[model samples]
Target: MTDQTVPRKPPRRARGEGTVYWDKRLERFVATRIVGYDDRGKEIRKRGSGKSRSAAMEALRLRVRDYERGLAPGADKTTVSDVVKDWILYGQGQVDDNTVKTREFNCAHIDAGIGDVLLRKLTTKHVEKLLRSMVATHSTRTIADVRACLNSAIKRAMARDLVDRNVVELVVTPRGTTGRKSKSLTERQALEVLTLTKAHWMYAYIVVSMLVGIRTEEMRALTWDRVDLDSEPATVAVWRSVRKSGDTKTRKSRRTLAMPDLAVDVLRRRRRDQDADRVKAGADWKDTGLVFTTTLGTALDSANVRRGFRSALGAVPSVNPAEWTPRELRHSFVSLMSAGGAAVEEIAHVVGHSDTSTTERIYRHELRPVIQTGATFMNRFAAVDVVAPDWHMEPLFRLPGEERTAHA
Candidate 1:
C-alpha cells in the first residue's frame, strides 16, 4: 500500500507568544500570556476569556499590546474615577483656588456618571452618553465644563499609559438646559437701589460698581494705597484682583479710572465707617487693607457680599433682591453708558475690554443698535435743531465745568 502522509501536528507556539485553549469544564475559550516576572521571580500571567477562540485571542492581544506600550499589567482595570481623582489631586499646578474648586465640582459630575467605566473600555459613545444625560438639569456651560474636566483627566491618564487615547476629545458636546440670563437695572431702578441701600453696608460697593464699573473681584481686592481721593479728579487703580496671580483679568484691566464724584463721596464715607469698625473690633481687627471688609476687618468674600447685597436690596420695594446679583451693577454701568450715548469704543476702554467687539458681544442687550457717534457728528456739522437726551449732554464723571465745556 502506498504510504499515506500523516499530517504533522501544528508547531507549538513559541514562549511568550501565549496559549489559547478550550476549557472543557467551562465550555469556553481562554487565553493567557506571560507578561513579566514577580518580585519573587514567579511568572506573572495576564488572562482573557471569551466564548470563542478568536475573541479570547483578541482580548489577550490587546492586553499584551498595552504591556508592550509600557502600561502596567492591570492597566485595563483603571476606571474613570481613578483617572479623574488622580488628575484633580495632582494635575492642577499653580492654579487659583477657585480654579481648583471649579475643577473638583465639575469632576464630581463625571464621577457620578461614568466613574466605574474601565479606561480601556471607554469610548466616545460613553462620553457622549454621559453629556446627554446632563442636558436636563445642567446648563450648556456646566456641561462644557464637565467635558473639559474629563478631557483633561483622560489626557493625564494617557501620559501614564493608563489609556491609549482621549475619547472625550472625539465626542461632541450636546445642548444643555437653558441658563439664567444676565440682566441690567434700568436707570430709575439703579437710583432706587442706591437710595434705598444708602444707609446699608453695601452702599459704597454698589456705588463704585454701578458708576465706575469695577468688577466684583476687583472691588474685593481694592486697597487703601490705590485710592487717590486727595488729588484733583480722584482716581482708583484697578490693577489687582482676587485671582491667585493677583493680576487683573486682562492687561487692559490694569488701568487707573477717574472716580465719579458719587464714587469718591461714597468711598470717603466708607473709609470713615471702616475706621469706626476698626475701633469697635479693637484687637480682633485683621487689618487686611481691603477696601471692603467684614466686622473683623477681614476681606469680603462673595458670600458675604451677596448676603449684604440682598439684605440691602430688601429695603427697596420695587427691586427684587432674588433677581439681581452684585455683578448686575457692572451690567447696569454698561447699560447706562450705552443709553447715555457713549461710543462702544470708549465704553470698551473704560471696561478694560481689548476691543469693542467684546464689549458689544457681552453687553449686546444693553447697547443701542445704532451708531450714535456718527449721527451726533453729522447733526453738529449740519447745525440741526434736533435735541439730544439729557444724559447725552451730561458727562459720565460730571466733573466741575465739564457740562458747560462740552456744550461750548
Candidate 2:
C-alpha cells in the first residue's frame, strides 16, 4: 500500500491513432484524432462529442473518414452561420454589389432560422422547415432566393469538403404566399395612363417604359450618351443598369432598341427639361448622367422611381396607385404589342429577352396562338341548339294516303 502509483491510465493513445473517452465534466463521450499541423507547425486535432457512446462513435468515424479524404479538420466545428459568413466574405468581388447585398439579406434570414446548425449535421428536413416557416412571411420569390443563397453557400462548403451534401437541393421549396401577378393595362387604359402622367416630371419615364419597354433599372441608369435622337430612326442603347458594376441583366440585354415616335418625342422633351434643371441647380446638381434623377440631379433610387410611378398612377380614376408597380409598364408593353398582332419573336427581341420561351412564359396571357380556321368549323355546331328529337321527326317518305297539295 505504501507504493501505489495510480497506474497512469494506459498512456493516452498515441497521436494519429484515434481514441474514444468518457468526459466526466462534459457528461458525454468524446472521440478525438490527430488531423494534421497548422501553418505554424502546431498540432491540428479534431474532436467529436455526443451524449451517447454510439453517437460519439459515429461522429468520430465521420471525422476520421473526412480527414483521410484530406478535408480540413476545422470544418468539423463549422456551423451554417460560419459557412454563410465565409461565403459572403469570399464572394465579395465575384458578383455585383447589389447581388452581394441581396445575398446578405437572404443569408441573414437563413441565419435567423437555422444558422446555429452544424454544417456537417444540416439535413433536408431542416431546410424544408426553414422554407415553410418563411412561407407566411416572405414572398415565394423571396423564399426561392433564400434557398438559392443557402444552396450556393452549402455548395461552396462541399467544394471545400466541409459538408457531405447540399441538403438545400434535396428539399422542394414549399409554396409561399401568393404574390401579385403581373398585368397589363387595356389599350384604352394604356392611353389614359400616358395622357394622365404627361404633365408630371416622370412623364417621359412612363412614356418610354410603355412605348419602348426599357427595364426600370436600365432606364434609371440611362445616360445622355446612350440616347440617340438625331439618328434617322432614334434609338436608345439598352446596355446598362443601375447595378453597381453597371452591367445589364444579361449579355443579350445589352441591345439597341429603335424608339417609337412617342418615345423619341418624350425623350427630346426630357432632354430640354433636364437642361433647364441643370441650369437652375448649377453647382448643387450631382451631374450623375442618369436619365432619371431628383430635383438636385442625383441618380434616382428604386424608392424614388416607385414613388414617382405611384404618383403618376394617381392621375387615373380606374386604376389604384397601390395596385400597380413600375415593372408593370414593361408588362403592359408586351401585352399591347401582342394585342396589336406583333410576332412573339419580335416582342422578345424588343424586350431584350434571350429567347422567345422567356417572353412567352412571362406574357402568356397576352399572346394568342396562331390558329387558322378551326374556329370557323367549330362555330356552326354551337348554333344547333334546337335539334328535333327523333320522335318528332316527320317520315322521310309519305304514305299513299298523304295530303296531295305541296303548299299545304
Candidate 3:
C-alpha cells in the first residue's frame, strides 16, 4: 500500500547525463532530459511523448543528438533560388530551351524576391507574401510554373547535398492547391486573331499554325518532303523546330502528325508560294526547303513571330477588348478542337502532347462523352476554306500586279 501511494516512475534511471523520467496527467513513461546544460545546470528540456517506454528512451537519445548538432525538431533553412540554380546547373544538358527558359526565369524571380534568405528562415508567412507580390505582376500560369520550378529545385538540391533538407517541399505551392488552369481563348476571339494574322504579312506561318497546330518555331523547320499533299489523308511530318540556337527545338520534336484538310490546304499554298519566291530570288532563298522561312531561308527569329503577332492583334477592331498574345493562338486551336468534341487522345496526338490527360486538363472545359474517338476526325473529309481564291505568289519587293512567278 505504501509503494502504491507513490507514482511508479522509472526509478529515475540515468540512460545518459541529464536524462530522467517525469510523470504528469499524461503517461508516466515520458522521458525528459536537459539537452543543453550550462555551468548553473539550467538548460533546455526535450520531452518525449511515446506510449512505449523504449520509444520514449529513443526520443530522449535523439533529442540529445539534435542538441549536439545545434537544432530543435523540424527546423530547416533553404532558399528558393539556391535550390533552383543547383538543379539547373546539375541538369546541364537534360532539358531543352523551352524547359530551361522557364526554369531560369523562375530562378531569377526567386533570386530577386528571396534568394538571400536562409531556408530555415523561410516561413509560411514569407511565402504567401512573396506569392502575392508575384501574382500582382505576372500571369497565373507563369507564377505557378515559377513556384513549381522552385519546389523541384529544392527536391534536387536535397539529393545533391546542396541543402540539409527541402523546406520548400514541405510548403504547399501557391497555385497547385488553388486548381487554376491557364486561360484559353474563345473560338470567336481566335478567329478574329487568325483573320488579323492573315492580313499582317505573315500569312504562310499563320496558316500552318492554325491548320496543323504546329508551334511557331516548328513552323520554321518544316520542309516540303515532310508534307504529303497528294495523300488522301494528307499529313505534316513535324521533323524539327527552330530554336534560339538557329536549329531544331528538340530531337524528340520530330513526330509525324495527321493533318486536317484545312491545314493541308494551307501548307500546299505556302509551299507553292515559297517555291515561287525562291525562283524569283534565284539564289537568295537557300534551298533548305523549310516550309516557313525568312527571306534568307534561314530559321525564323522568335522576336519576329512576337512582333507579327502583336501587329495582328492591334489590327483587329472587335478583338480590342480581348487581351491575348500569339501563343494564346495555340491554346485557341486546342480549345477549338476540344469544342468540336474531338477525343482527348486525338487532340493530344494532333497537338504533339505526350498524354491524353494533358489534353483533358488544358481543355477540360471542352470535354464531352461522344466516345474517345482518338485522331479519327483527322481522316474526315476535307473542309478546307480558301482564304485567297486564285491566289498566286507575289514578288517580295514587286507591286501586286507587277509580281511575276519565278520558276525554280
Candidate 4:
C-alpha cells in the first residue's frame, strides 16, 4: 500500500506573534494577537476584524496597543453597565444615604441610554448624546447631576484600570430646562401666611423659620437641650441636622441664633404642645428630641415639612399654595430683615453664612435696593447739591498773598 502524505494546516503562530486569516462565515479578514498572559499563565488573545486584510491588521495593532497600555483588560466583553456597577459597589460607603440614592437615580439614566456600550469603546460622543437626551426631558440641574454621576463613576473605573480614560469628562453638557427661581412672599403676603398658620401644628416651625431663617433640616433636628429659652436672650443652637450623619451642612451653618420675640413666643407654645402630645402618646412616642415632630414625637422629614407648609398655605388666599415652598420662608426672612434696614453683614451672620458673598448671591433679589445711598449721602455735603438753598461756592486756588473770598 502507498502511504499518501496528508496536507496539514499551517502551524499556529508563535506565542508573542499574531496571525491573520480570512473568515469564510463572515466574509471578512480576521486578525488575532497574543497580547499578554494572565496570572494563571493563560494566554490573553486580542482579536479584531474588518472587511479588508489591511483594515483588520490596523484594528489588530490598535488592540495590541490598548493591551500594552493596560486599557480595560477584556474590555471587548466589559460593558459600561459592568463598570458602573463596579464603581457603585466600591463607593457604597463613601457618601451619605441621600447622595447614594441620588447617584442611583442618575445611574438609571446612564443605563437606560448607553450602558450596553463597551467600557473601553465609550467616547465623548456617547456621553454628549446621553446628556442631550436628558436635556430634552429634564431640568438643567437634573442633567448636571446625571453628568456628575457618570463622570465620577467612570473616573473611579479608570483609577481601577478598568478604563483608559473617563470620556464623560470630555463631553460638553448641553443647556437643559431652566428651573423655577427661588422667591419670597411680599410683606403683606408674609403677614397673611403667618396669621393663617397661627392655629396650625406647624405654627412654631413656620414662625421660627420666617424669623430666624434657619434651614428646615436644622429646625427639624433641633432639640430641647440646644434651645436656651431661659437665657437673657432666647437662642437656638443649630448644631445638628436630620442628615444621616446628624451634622449641619457646613461649619458656619452650625450656629447660635437669638430668637425674636415672635419666635420665642411660638417656641414656648410649641413646647407646651409637645408636652401634651407626649402625655397623649405615652409609651408610643418615639422621644427623638426633635423640635419638629409628628404626633408620635418622631422627627419630621423633608416631605413632612413640605406637606405641612402647603397645607398652611391653604389658609392664605392671595398666594398660590402650589408655587411656594418651605424654603421660601427663609427667603422671606431675608427680605423682611432687608426691608427693616438690616445691614448685609448682619444678615449674613444671622443666617449663618460663612461670608456675605453667599448671602448676596442667593438672596440678591431679597437684598435691599442698591439705590446709591452713598451718592445721596455725599450729595448732602456737595458744592453742587441740587437741594441747597444757597448756591455760593469758593475756589481753593487763591495765590499766597491774595485774599480768599466766596464766589456766587
Candidate with maximal TM-score: 4
Output the number of the lDDT-best candidate. 1
Q: Which stretches of candidate 1 lie over 4 Å from their true place?
A: 1-56, 67-74, 95-99, 373-408
Give the TM-score (vs. native) of candidate 1.
Answer: 0.78
Question: How big is the positional error of residue 329 in model 2, measured in Å on the Cα after superposition?
Answer: 0.9
- Per-residue C-alpha lDDT of model 2 across residues 283-313, encoded as one tens digit per residue: 9988888777888889888889899999989
Clashes of each: 0, 0, 4, 0
Please write out the lDDT profile of model 3 over residues 194-272, one tens digit for every residue.
Answer: 6665645566566567656777767756778888888878777886665545444445455777777667766667777
TM-score of 3: 0.58
Displacement of residue 200 (Cα, Å) in model 1 is: 1.4
How many clashing residue pairs are found in candidate 3? 4
Writing each residue's lDDT as its tens digit, candidate 1 over 359-386 gives 9888888887467678788878765454
Residue 277, candidate 1: C-alpha displacement in angstroms: 1.9
Instruction: State the lDDT at 165 in candidate 4.
Output: 75
In candidate 4 the C-alpha lDDT for residue 47 amounts to: 83
lDDT of 2 at 131: 92
Task: For each candidate, give its TM-score against the true structure.
Answer: 0.78, 0.78, 0.58, 0.79
State which candidate, 1 or 4, has the greater TM-score: 4
